[model samples]
Target: MRKHHAQQLYDYHVWANDKFFARLKELPEDIYIQEIQSVFPSIAETLVHMYMVDTIWLGVMKGNSMAEIQASIASVQEITKDNQLQKMEKLFQDLSAEYQTFLHHESDLDKEISPEHPQFGRLDTQLSELVQHVVNHGTYHRGNLSAMIRQQGYASVANDYVFYLYEGKAEK
Candidate 1:
């Protein structure tokens, strides 16, 4: 079962992202959106970029039109709202649902997807890798987001996978 391992990883990632963002909301709005020394431009912009790119890659892996994912995110960047916390929740929810559907439909663990990455060139990867990459990608930016927020003097909860495993509901 390739699917089992991949799904397990996906479950862990969804668990981690949800908890991470929930704690992220505790930080003041200004701090969360603030620019500081980060892996990306600003915490806010990077977070948007993370979700957008992830959907693109995931869409490509699942044979979904990457354009839809691109357009969905391009719409958000045009005008980010003040209620960013709500927006983040929506993004997470959508990603969670999409990934869940992907897992269910892709029951074959050995399935392969070869997609060309603009930066990395062509990638011949397992579905497991694609699923894991999105989670890892999001977590990296979430870390960037946390650090950026704290640089402006805001506190954040630890959003690690181990923390989620010990503390939160994982089956949802």
Candidate 2:
């Protein structure tokens, strides 16, 4: 089912993340940190936004309240790259773990779970939808971050999911 693709995407997503961060680290730190993009404002902001969406989506999937989700996002925002790569890796790991858990524990991926999204209002979603949400959301903001790197005169790695799958190995 969708869980198979979800499992594959977990690997792809993390590979892309490692590639993105490697490119970031390769860039001159000052330019990497200073190059500002309107969409994300800064590379740091883009990274934080990715983790925020993770928290938001993961919380909802865990049956946590919107209020609790917001708190999770706030805490994620405080995590700077230097401050928490180990922790970030764990969150990325959890993304895969949680997805697997939901796949097994739930009787059906199509079952509607309508949870109140604080900003989006009522959202009737499937487990599949949440998996899709994180993949699509991560890809979008990672693109923003990649563009920022290119704008700063750096070559960005291929972060497309297809690219990641075809490559079959994480870079760095």
Candidate 3:
């Protein structure tokens, strides 16, 4: 896809994440750290993983080592210990701002980036592909969040791409 299309997708990703996170904030604080049987163990873990992975990809794009990326965000203990939700909100806000600035200066979506992960091996892909992967990755885990929310007897927010579009954010 084109860089503009990728930017739109990333914008939608941020919009959807905000909707889900806002809904999460309405729930009792304990529910976020409560252990549950799901993809990532608990709501807090899932959210933290999303932030970590997003940071990793963005860091790689910016030419940082994995160690640098991991050190940039809060530790796993801090995220699950106290003020977990607030920490996540701040993390996403910071990451989203950096992502927007990166995109604004980006003009070569077709440029190839080879980022390696110890477990996932190495990827040889275009920058646009990495951007799309970030969007898709968030969407998948947001579904997990929806299920987790339902398990807690609460309704999750609507975070569909169409919903974002209908909200007129797609025009931005």
lDDT top scorer? 3
- Top candidate on TM-score is 3
- The 0-to-1 C-alpha lDDT of every candidate, in the order given, reads 0.70, 0.69, 0.84
Report the C-alpha lDDT of model 2 over 1-172, residue by residue, as the tens digit.
3345554565576678878766666667675447474597777667766877776777887778878887876776665445344455566666656755765676665567888865779887776678677878888888887788788777888888777757755433
Q: What lDDT is reached at residue 148 by model 3?
A: 93
Order of candidate numbers by lDDT, starting with the best: 3, 1, 2
Indicate the worst ten consecutive residues by lDDT in candidate 2: 80-89
Candidates 1 and 3: which is better by TM-score? 3
Question: Model 2: runs farther than 4 Å from truth?
Answer: 1-3, 80-110, 169-172
Q: Residue 17 in candidate 3 has what lDDT?
A: 89
Q: Candidate 2: RMSD over Cα atoms? A: 4.0
| lDDT of each residue in 6-94, candidate 3, tens digit only | 88899999998899788888889888988999998899888888887887788888867878766765564455355478878887888
As for candidate 1, its clashing pairs are none
